[model samples]
Target: MARDDRAVGVSSFEGQATSAGQASLAGEATGTASASGPHFAAGPPAETGEPLRHPPHGEGDERAGEVSAGGRGRPSRAPPSLSWLLFSRLVFPGIFLASGLAGLLTLREIVAPPLDMPRILSGLERGGSARAEALTQVHEAILDPRYRDLKADPELAESLIRVLETELRQPITGSPEFTVAYRAQLCRLVRELDTPRTVPVLLIAVECRIADTPQLDSPIRRAAAEGVVTALERHGPDCVRSVPGGVAALCRAAKDPVAPVRAAAAAALGHIGGDEVCDLLREMLHDDTDVVRYNAAIALAYAGRGTGLDTLHEFLRSENVRNLADTGSTESVIGDRTCKLLCRALFALDRLCDRSTEERLAVLHPAMEDLCLSRAPEEVRTLAMRVDLKIERFHR
Candidate 1:
């Protein structure tokens, strides 16, 4: 189970070899015993007009997987007629070429940057379907076979993370809009993967991006910062571990000036735990932002840290502890936060019940009940219910 916890990541650098010898396979594409290379004849004895010879009944395929005199599976791979090199070897990788072109076009379209939306109900309704479509295309171009290949191989997930970090850290030069847009798109794709094996790769990629997140106020930087928190929020503890300096980076980012980013950081730290992570979370308990403090309580409980439950206690009593699911925009940071708030609380209760003690749950019962009663989404309510089940199981 412990082994099952640490997940895989992604990479495209050392993906399938690009030098695929594209032989102009002109042979008979046969499914018979006499099929040969691209140039070979299909039927038996194209020259011999006699009856077909047999190797005796029950004597088929004497050399399974091995090449026979007829060059069965070996040389018959291709007649070697149609340019057995990477589209004539002159043009190495077509995918990378395509990616480069697509990337350029994407940059061309990224002329304008997104404007800031104040935390208003109306603003939250403004959406980004166009940007989302553009981002999806970019993710495919950047990830594609690389992401697919990495998901299939657990052995290479660690190295994939390393390569991604190295790649993201390289000198990023482009139009301000393009640079941020590209990085943000890549960062967002980190969670698009389904396999647990890709977790490490996604985790490190996000951390390195956050570490690379510039201190200045740019949309790209904000995106990077938000991406880190988003990933942690999405994957939780699965995103923890294996990242070299991830804890330190999150600890630092927890103090980010951006409220959403700071809340995200606090939320993420709970998924991963250590003496250092605990210390940072404890400190965040006193953070000026109510969002940060609220997230810190959940994280601390998830980490099984017996912290002073002051924030959670107060939060449970606050009237604003309910869901704000009315946000219609996917891009509004305020909407994102508002909607996720109750969900985050529900998620925390579930984690705490799964990983904490009966003693902790006793103190948590009131707040947990309040969260469970809140009109959260279906999944969030389910999470809250699961905690109740866990508590009952513990008592039994």
Candidate 2:
């Protein structure tokens, strides 16, 4: 009886196993299996709550074998590598921050300009459109109170002047704007300051005639000429030679049809003492315009070149003869004044003449005797006596 029971139990177990295999095969065929365990089971389903779908042959299992090899397929839960995160978040912002700071600093420099003499000089040396722009900025800066104080510093002033001179010499070809701007600035500086320190610089600018560009408008040239005059007055003859082409320019102006120009030239020549200047004065003495002649005489006398004495003496003698014929007391008075100027000129010439003592005495003796014996003013007699004594002593 026990052997029988054992056989029945074995059969029952076999039957159960067969039934489970059949169920698994049916579930797989129907595509309704929960892929939770090795074998299919009829239960609540997997925690993922989905049925397993088998792929066809030669096709991959998308859920089980698919991979996001290059981050293409699925989203990831883990944070990216620290370096990558830093590159994404901090790198660009840091760069932008650095750039912003630099830009701000540059803007500040522009808004509140500094002297920056070296930089300004460098820009001026470049001498192009950029140089022109830099020069304009420098001029504006100079007018600013911040840089206005720099004028008090002689070294700074000299450096600035040198920069301007360099710009004038540079061969920059472009618009006339730079040229105009440069002349205006120089004129302003010269007019504003009367310091001896500025004298040499203004003289250099004048001598070069750097302001005399083809594009110079009328007002600009006038301003530049005025500056030249101021420099001439302040520094006198020594500064004239230091100016590059100053003497030649003034000599040319001596022939200008404009009376003021001729007058200014005469005055400039007077301030600039030289043998060449004396010749120019002598030429001016013969000018048709009395005003020109008068200025020339005054200038030549002031210069003490004494080259105009003979011309002045002839003019005075002619005037006297005309006065005698016309019986014009005014003409006579004018002649008397001319005689005085002539005597003074002769005395000056006697002193400067390179001739021997006997020759100088021979020339001066007649003029001295005439003035001493003439019914001239007391001042004239006194001046004649003084000149005679000088001549006598000089001869001895």
- TM-score, candidate 1, is 0.47
Query: Candidates' lDDT values, in order?
Result: 0.55, 0.59
Q: Give the count of colliding residue pairs in each prediction.
A: 7, 0
Error of 1 at 380 (Å): 2.8
lDDT (tens digit, per residue) of candidate 1 on 292-327: 788888778767765836676666555454433222
Poorest 10 consecutive residues by lDDT, candidate 2: 321-330
Poorest lDDT segment (10 consecutive residues) of candidate 1: 15-24
Instruction: Count clashing pairs, candidate 1.
Output: 7
Best by TM-score: 1
* Candidate 2 segments exceeding 4 Å error: 1-152, 170-178, 181-185, 191-225, 241-263, 286-298, 304-396
- Give the per-residue lDDT of model 2 (tens digit) for 1-396: 999999999999899889877877878876666554334545544666887765787465354335666555764476789999898899989999999999998776557645677776677666667666665765676666545565465554555566656655655456666655656566566444444455444434433333344334333333444565566666666566765676777787677655655665675676676788888798898888764675576567566555555544454345452342234232455656555444444444444433333333445556666666666556556666776777667766
